[model samples]
Structures are given as C-alpha cells and as structure tokens.
Target: MTSKYMALPKGMSESSFDAAIEKFKKALGAENVMIKDEQVRPYTKVMMAVPTEEHTPSAVITATTVEQVQAVVKICNEHKVPVWTISTGRNFGYGSAAPGRRGQVVLDLRKMNKIIHVDPELCTALVEPGVTYQMLYDYLEENKIPLMLSFSAPSAIAGPLGNTMDRGVGYTPYGEHFMMQCGMEVVMANGDVLRTGMGGVKGDKAWQVFKWGYGPTLDGMFTQANYGICTKMGFWLMPKPPVFKPLEIQFDEDSDISDIVEFIRPLRISQVIPNSVVIAGVLWEASTCNTRRADYTTEPGHTPDAILKQIQKDKHLGAWNVYAALYGTKEQVDVNFKIVQDALKQLGKGRLITEEMAGDTQPFKYRAQLMSGVPNLQEFGLYNWRGGGGSMWFAPVTQARGSECDKQKSLAKKILNKHGLDYVGEFIVGWRDMHHVIDVLYDRSSEEETKRANACFAELLDEFEKEGYAVYRVNTAFQERVAQSYGKVKRDVERKIKRALDPNGILAPGKSGIDI
Candidate 1:
C-alpha cells in the first residue's frame, strides 16, 4: 500500500512530516498549505529523462507576504525540512514547478505576485516573484506606459524575478535579464530579510535605478542558489522605440553556420545589431512553426538529412535561420538595417527576409515578436517536434566565433544523431558569446526511446566536456553532474556558503548541487 503522500524528505519520520505540515498550514493559512497527493501532483511534473516520482514534492506552501515567507523559512529550519522555492513555477524544459530533488516541500511564490512599482519616466519597475511578463505587459498597456519588455519565449507565464534569478536571456537590447536588474529583496534561510543594492538604504530613491550599492553586490549571490528565496526584484525596461524592423537571414546549408557567425559577430559586437540575435537551426525553426516529426519520416532513428533538406525546400526555410532586429528612429532603423544588409551581403548567400515578406509566416513571426519585446508562447512548439511530452534544454555557452560555433554544432549533432535523436538547437548570439541551446526531445511513452534519450544526454555532457564545453544550466535530474563540471574548488566554496547560511540545509538541499 502507498503511504499518504508520494515522498518525504530523507531521514524524516512520518509524524515529524505531519507536524511540519501542520505548522506550515498554520503559518500560510489552510488554503495555502497543500498536502494531498493530487494537490501536489502538478508541482512534481518533470520533463527530464527521469520519472516524475524522482522530483515529486512532499507538499506545497503558498506565501503571499514576506512575513509569511519568513515564518515558513523559520519552521523549515526548526524542523530541518528543506523547501524548494519557485517564483511562478513555469520553468519549462528546466524542471517546471518541480523541486531540484524529490521530497522537498515546494515554496510556491506565485501568490506573492505583485507589481510593486513602475516608473514610466525612468523606465524601471519593482516587481514581486509572481509578476509574469504578460502581467507587466498588460499593466503597461492599460496604463498607456510606453515601455518594451524583453522576456523569454514563454513570457506569457514566466515571471521576471524567476527568469532574472535564473539568468535567463531574452531577445532585446536589455536581453541579459540579470544585468538589467538593479535591486532585489530576498528572504534568507535564517528567516532574515536581506535587500541587495540600493534596497538596503532606508528610503532609498534609486532602489530600482541603481544596480550596485557601495558594498559587495549580493544580488547575484541569491541567483541560482538555495541560500535565499527572492521575494522582489527591480529591473530596467526598454523604452518603446519609434521604429522597429525585424529581419531574418536564411542560409541554405548546415555547413554555412561558420560563415553566419563570422559575419554577424562584428555587427553584434559593434552594437549595429542591438537585440540578442538568434541563429536557429532548421528543425528548431520548423518546430516553432508547428512542424511535427510525423510530417516527415518517423522511422525510429534521426530524420534523414535528405528529408531535412526537403522540409527546408517545402517550407521555404533555411538550414540556418538568423533572426535579429533594428530599433531606433525611422532614419536610424533604415541606416542600421542597411548595415545589417551589407553584413549579410558579406556571406554572399544569406537570403534576407523582411517582416513584410514573412507576412505572419510562423517562426519568423514569433521570432520578430520576441525581438520587438512582445511576449508569446509560440516557442512551446518545440514539444510538438517529437510529441513525447519530454524535453530537456542542453544549453552550453561558447565564444561567438564562426569556428567555435561550427565545432560545437558538429559535436552536438554527432552525439545526438549517434543516439538516434535529432539535433534541434539554436545559437542565441550575445555581445561576444553564444548560448547554444538544444532541446533534447524524445518520446517518453516509449521505454526504448526514453532509455536512449537518457543515455544521449549523459553522453552529450561527457563528450562536450571532453571538448572543453560545459552546460550553463541543467534540469533537476542532472544538477549534481553539471555542478561537477565547475570543478571541486567552486563546489567547496558553495558548500561552505551553504553551511554558513543554511546550517540545517532547510532551503533546497540539492539545488545547484549545494547542501549543508
């Protein structure tokens, strides 16, 4: 017979767990504390190569105020109960809603969502963890504030606080979410409230405008760590430009990746292309446009290159699709667009497709929307590529050099194809770096495919590391392995910090593989 719950924290007695749940209910109100298996099931849903049971949360606690969060942390410390904190719990492909490991109570902060303040004049905002991109966008629109929001593709559901804390990038001038952040309000594991940057100063006027206060900047420390739960964040917003022009340069062959990066790097570094340029593979583009594996040959192994070529031909797509935009006044956009056109001309073969030519044609439409600071869920089409309800983001950072990108793409494709999976990936071009994001898609319903996907992810990690490459982030199942990639010294330092701040390890014991 199954116990009353799916799982509990290791070494904790059932009676102790019950007592902790009682205390949590008392602190968060009965409606906020959820313990039933069904009520907690949604938080445990994971899309990794592992079973959902592996990441199942023991219970869920929703906190609407910092005082409630402090109380929860105190109780967790008191009972030595670890809690996994999530802002909106919309972290898809990176363990959405699930804890870093099994049995940790989920501290649901979606209820704390509040757009605390917005200064249209200064183009800054102070928001709680639950304020989603769509929420802020709506707020700006309803109030007639002329501001642009740069958010991840899943902007409709994901929040700024969570995305910034995770260091997620978007497709705009202020795409580097963390860098755009000015301040933060975090609840430490010891039940203390810590404000970073200008938030610490009493009646500080520049809390949302200044990122670095006098002392050591602690805003970054709380990110991607279990040391604290972030309740509020402050960040800058791009003022709506007078004119926006989105463009796509399509390259015919897979080998053209090298030339694509070579030509684009200079323009990006020089700020001619101000937005985060995305060089998406054909499959990635196709997937975003609702193309499914079933549309092509589905004969088990990787889709044949011949079929891929045919899809490109039929859909009027390029093997390597480059997406970026020009924003400024009419004259400025025209000049920048001409400069971009001149750069693409250097490639000698990039087919430039403008917004008018795209004409609501998928991928490009959504991509343009993203580059223009519009929130959309169209990128979720990646799941329909394999139709297995399984996906893991295998992201690795690399220099924005032609040869480096080519090498990484070749290596990734070789590894993925060797395991009979397709290489559906993209290179998000930054100022001087590329965030090579690959969605490792598989059909979890098939035991064989699931096994292959798991093995493929591990081998991808191993082989990529051998080539001096490591992932920037990973799903819950592989946090420990990814942590090892940073080396032992860093791990030791993190452990020391965890011990110092969270002696009882009550806040997400396995988060980023750090624990007391």
Candidate 2:
C-alpha cells in the first residue's frame, strides 16, 4: 500500500530516495519523519481546482528546533530533493500544507511552538514559527498584559509568523502584518542561520523594536519567495486603547459601492479612520449567518439578483456592508464617531449601525470582534455557503479610486456569472490602495463543476492581466502563470538570486517560477 502511493523526487530512483528518507529519519528522530500513505495524505490535500496528486509530497519531516531544520536542509541538498516549507500549514485558500510541485519533501515547522519573549513596556514580541494568534492572545491575557493583537479573520488557528511572512492583513490599525515585522531568524539553504535587521548584533537589545539595520535590508526577499525558511520572528504589538468603538454602515444599492469607496478614501488617507476598513458584499456578509446556497435555490448557475435581494432582506443585510473601528481616548472616539455619523447621514444611502444597535448579531458581531483585536473563527462559515469545501481567493491590488473599484467589481461579476458561480467578495481599504479579495467558491465534488471552476479561474487571470490588473497572491496551481505577468526581466533576476542562494535547487523549485 505504501509503495502504491510513493512519489519519488525527479532524477531520484526508489533505492536512492529510500536512502535519503533514512537520513532524514536519523537527523530528526524516527518518529518525526512521515512517509506512510496515510501520514502523507493530509499534506497533499489542496482546496484549489487542480488535482491533488500534482502537489503530493514524497515525505514529511517535522522539525522541533532550528538545528533540526538545518539538518533537514543539508540532507535535501545532498540528495537533490526539493523541500517546501510551511509554518503552521493552515494557509487555507492558499495551498495549505502542500508542496509547489510533485514529489518534494514537506518541511513542517509547526512543532517549533514557542513564545521566546514579550516585553510589556516596549510592546514587542519574539516568537517561534508556531506561536499562533490565539496562543499569544491567551498569553497576554493570562499575564495581564495591556497589548492588543491584530490578525486575519481566521485568527484562532492562524499564526503571526506565517501570516506576516505571507503579507496577510488584519482589521486593526496595524493591519499590515509584514510592515509591523521588525526582525527574523532564517535558516538558509546552506544550513546557516542568518538573522535580519538588528538581530545580527551581539547582545542586541532592540531587535524587536528597531526594523532597519546598518546595511541593506533582506527581510522583504524572504516573503513570497523560496530563498530561506524563517524559524523565529520579532514584531511590534499595539497597546490597548482607552476606548474602542466598532461601527458598520449599510448601503442598500449595489450601485452605491462607488460612492461608498469615494467617501471612505479621504477618511482613510487622512487617518480619520485608523483601522483597515472592510466593505463586504451581500453574499459575503450573508454567508456569516450560516446561509447556504441550497436555502435560496438549488439551481446550478449563479443565484439570481432577485434571490440575492431576498436574502439581503431576510437577513437584514445591505447590498454592501462597511465595517470600521475607532480607537483612542473617550474624547477622541466621541469626536470621530460624530464625524462618521454625520458623513454617512449626508451620504443619504447608508444606515449606520453601532455596537449598541448591532448587539450580538452575526456577521457584525464577528466583524466587530476582529476590529477590536479579538480572535474568532466566524469567517470560516464561508466554506458552507457553496457546500463542497472549495475556495480560492482572487486578490487584486487597486487604487483607492471609486471608478477603479467599480470597474473591477463589474468585470469580476461578469466572469463569475458566466461560469455559473457566485461573486463572494470584499474590498479591504488601505490608505492609498485596496486589496480587492474575491473568494471563487465552487463545488469540487462534481466533476463538471470542478472543470468549470478551473476554466473560470484561468479566464479571470487572463482577462484581468489584459486590463493591467494582477493578483497579489495565488495558490500553487497558478503561481507559475501569475509570475509571468510581472515580466521576463524580473523573472530572470529572481532565478539568478535563487541560483546564487540555492545552487542545487533543493528549495521549492516551482515557487514563483524561480528555480536554478
């Protein structure tokens, strides 16, 4: 049975691959290495439209310490086996626990769960790869620390190190995860540990407080790249505010999306809205209330606008829901609240909902939880909306202009409706940009639907590129295609760097299409 599912690395015979596995088992302990069919099955599970066999791993090596990671890298280099590294393996819509290509080893770093240090005065923390948001939150709460945490919606299970390295965002003022990162300890391809930023200095006191070192900064290179495996990281923490006010604005018309963005852009740019604001669509907000597609219609195609309007009415949801929060002293929040309320009233189409009005209501409750720096898994309800456990996040960066957002929404909806799928999307507003995130939900159980989903995703990539819009991140199935959109010169330069750092191509070879 094990032999039936065995997938050896390219250019490696069965016997040679067996020898490499033995070395891996000896380096990390026999129990830490997994090569059985059942043990390796979970590593190959992917939610993308592609086949799972395409991302199968030859084996899984769990590392508990930085030294063990170095040992695994050395063995892979010697055997010419490619290795794909994952921090907690909970990257959900983005290739969770899977390799970039077939037959590469999976370097699972989840066993390295340790919170190295947390300074209450400096509001800084040094943590291992597996220190999850919930874990850190519990630590701060237990110790009576006054620091707050900002994390992605799946904050209960997701870790900061992986999300920060992947450049994910949260709903708090410090939503840009990577921008808050100060330093990191990475395990290089050559089995050496390189510390970034102020960490390189002996007896460094400000490693987690200072971001820049004396020379060139290398922290940005490791993100979204396969240059090194980050073992430990340091980042800043936001201090708890004197008062927190989470609010929502509901717009009745789908056409009001442009006007809504136009109004919010100035507020965000001027720092009047201190948190990362979320403008979610009707379907996206409805999904949070446990509403399923089967409830409204059993039809195979996209749900009609009539039924969508009905759902919005039944759930008391707007065509678009805007969520943002204000933090600071009581006086500061009072002044900002008045400004927000007056502006929305002047806009005429929006109905403002404060914490008092939205008490314990779903969707709003979860959104409020996130903006207030609490951990919750309420957003996971999105998986049940389509009901086949298929989700792909098609995220594109756009200017914070009203016209640009309207154009993107129209194009995305047209393409999705053409493929018999619903458009469950949102716009996460930044100071000068918007992360337009659209979850391409489908039923993977049906062969026909799976094929259609694959085609739909491809068409989205092609059409968006022609319009000069590109996705910020994609799953393993489309990484190579998305990398081409950047141009040949950038691709060539990335390859040169990959070769210089990892000559044997032992790291993730197909990652961003940059391999030696």
Candidate 3:
C-alpha cells in the first residue's frame, strides 16, 4: 500500500542514500534523526485516506534549532532531494507531516517549539513553528495576563504556525489568524533566508504591526503555497476586552435562515459585531456534539427522514443556531444583546438563550471563556471526533444577496447527500462578505467512503466555481481542484511567482498544487 509517487529517485543507489544519511546525522545528532521502519513509515503517508500499510523514508531529520533546519535544507538542495516541514504532524486531512512528492526527507520541527517573546506593550508574540494553541493559552492564563488569544475551534492541540499558514479561522474578533500575522522568517528553496515586512531591517521592531514593503506583500506568498520553510513568525494579540458576551439565536424552520442572514449583515458591517459571526445549522451542532442519536445510528436501515423526525420530536432540530460575541463595556454587551433580540423578534424569530439557559452553570460565562482564547475542550474529550483522521474545507461567500447564499447552501447539501456524506455548513459573517465553511466529515477506513467523499468534493468545486464562489482553504488531496477555481490566468501568475521564489521547488513542493 505504499504510495507509488513517494518512491526514492529512479536511479538513487544505496551508497548515495547512505552518504546523505551520514551527512544528516553529522549535522544533527544521531538521536535527533529517526530512520527506523516504524518511525519513518508513519511519516510517509498522509491522513486523507487510510495511511498505506508500509511507509519507508529515505530519512527523517528532527531539527532542534533553526540553524539545523538551514543545514538540512542546504543538504537537500545540494542532493536535489525534497524536504517536507512538519510541526507536531497534526494536520489531519492535508497530509500530516508527509511530503506530496516521494523520496523527500521529513523535517520534523516539534523540537523548535518555544515562546521566544511576549511583548505586552507592543501586543505581539514571537513563537517558533511548533507552539500549539493549548500551549499559548496555558501561558496566557497561568500568567493571568490581560491579552486575548484568538484560536480555531479545536484549539486543544493544533500548532499555531500550521493553523496560520493554512489560514485557519476562529470565532473571536481576530478570527482571520493569518491576517493577524505581521512577520515571518522563511528558509527559501535554495537554503537562503528571507524575512517579511520590517523583519528585513536590522534591529527594527516595526514587524509587530507594519506588514508591507515598498513593492509587493510577500507574506501572503508563503501561505497555501510551496514557497519556503516558515521557521519563526510573529502574530498580533487581541487586547483583553472590557467585557465579552456570547449570544445565540435559535430558529425552527429551514426557510428562516435567509431571514437570519439578512438581520445580521448590517450589524456585522456596522462594527456593532466586529468578531466573526457563525450561523450553524441545527444538524451541524447535533452532529458535532453527538447529541442527535438519529444521525449517528449504527442500524443499517436508518434513513435521513427518520433521523429528521427523531430530531423534530426531541425539539433538538433548532432549524439554525447563530453564535456571536460582543466586546466592550458591560453596558455595551447588554445593549447589543437587546438590539439582537429585538431584531430577531421583528423577523418573527426571537427565541434565544445565553449562559442563562444552564441557570447556575452560566453558559454565557463559558462562552466568554472561549472568547478569551484559552484551550479548554480537552477536558470534555470532544477532541477525539475524527479517531485522529479527518479534513476541513473552508468556502467563503458574500452575503450581499441572501438568495445567492441560500442557493449555494442548497447546491452543496444536495451534492453531499448524493454521495452519502454528512456536511455541516457554518456561516462566518465578515465585515462585507460571509465565509460559509462547509465542514465535511467522513470515515477514512472505508475505501468506498473515501472515493465518494472525493467525488462529492469535486462536484461541489465545479458547481461553486461556475457560480463564482472561491474556496479559502483546500486539503492537499484536492489542491488541483482548488487551483482551478482561480482560473487559468491566475494559476499561471501563481506559477510564475512560485518559480521566482522557489526555483528548485524544494519547499512544500506538492502543497497547494502550484508548479514551477
């Protein structure tokens, strides 16, 4: 079951590989390199489909310092071998720690994890590639600091650098994590170094805010591309808000989603609701929380209609759930809550709930805790959803016209259903547009399920492209489909950029499906 695409170079000899292994071991201590069959095998296969039964790596080099990373890259460049950079190897669906092209040595960076600096005055933090959200959260809370951390939904174990590099979104005001990043230190394709923003200037602190040069914005070039190894990066931190309130609005019918969308658009753009607004369908919440037994039935004869009926009977089918956070003064939150309630009532849909629903438990307070950006979900054990294998696709759409949003949702659901896959569509309302993240979950163990999932994803891409919608984040498994959405012209332009930045195509070669 080894990947045919991942074999050693066609004519590579034992002596050549042995020589490379010796050089790697000499550069990095023997303990830092893992070349055993069991160790290197898992690093070879990705988590998209079930990993191949056997995986053999030319070598696995663990770099403890940036200098070692440079040495590893230098060696790979000299030998024309590929190098794959992995931090924690938790990138489930997008080929975790596995190189897209075969024969590449895995560059594990978990050892480089370090919170080098936390500048409260400048409101920025410098971290290595291996720092996890959980680690950052613990540091912030243990110190009882006033700064806020914006983290993705499953903030328990995912690395901050990998999430930002992939453009992961969170539920706080600074949900766009990548946009919050200011500067980075990248090891280019030929073992050279490049710094973004003011990082190029010696002894400059402007990297905490300024994000542009006299010419182009190079930071974006590193994201979702085969550009270079991002060794160190700095991201902006949210100042602790005076008050945080998490609110939810519930609905009971499918047609009411459009009404809810229309009601929130103005509030989002007006800065009244500056954070990311998520409108999750009831089914999505049920599936994610495992509260709806109807959907997770183990019986072979289960039907969607039966599941829908059960959900309705339990009154758990809250046609939709809207989640938002209000920051500022306590008075401002109270005012905003009232405005939101009143607006929903005007549309004949005001049945709402806050932490008040749990009475003494205080769900609002818990929502505030989440808004604080601390990683607390591990205690609940919900982090084990995928059995350690799953993928996420982020699709962004504008809400200028509610009808168009509805149409897209309908088309997406129909396609997913056609393939017998479960999908949850969440609406992330930005200032002027909406990012409808369609979270698709499937079992990687079944080959039939894997093929069906791929087909459904491909169909959705074709339909969305024809309708003028763009996918914000795509799994490495479907990179080609995602690049095609940008059209031939943009693809060519991206190719030219890749060639200019990475002439050897050594860094993240198969990522984003961009070729030189």
lDDT of 2 by residue, 130-188 (tens): 88999999999999999999999988989999999889999999999999999999999
lDDT of 3 by residue, 148-168 (tens): 888766567787788898887
Residue-wise C-alpha lDDT for candidate 1, range 276-395, written one tens digit per residue = 999999999898888999998869889999999998998889999999999999999888888887766766898999999989888888888898777899999889999978899999
Query: lDDT values of the candidates?
Result: 0.90, 0.91, 0.71
Candidate 2 differs from the real structure by a C-alpha RMSD in angstroms, to one decimal, of 1.1
Candidate 2 vs 3: which has more lDDT: 2
lDDT of 1 at 74: 91
Which has the better TM-score: candidate 1, or candidate 3? 1
Those runs of model 3 whose alpha carbons end farther than 4 Å from true positions after fitting are 1-14, 50-58, 292-296, 299-303, 312-317, 359-369, 378-396
Range of the 10 consecutive residues with the lowest summed lDDT in candidate 2:
1-10
**How many pairs of residues collide in model 1?**
0
Q: What value does the lDDT take at residue 418 in candidate 2?
A: 99
Clashing residue pairs found in predicted model 1: none
In model 2, the runs with Cα more than 4 Å from the true position are: 1-5
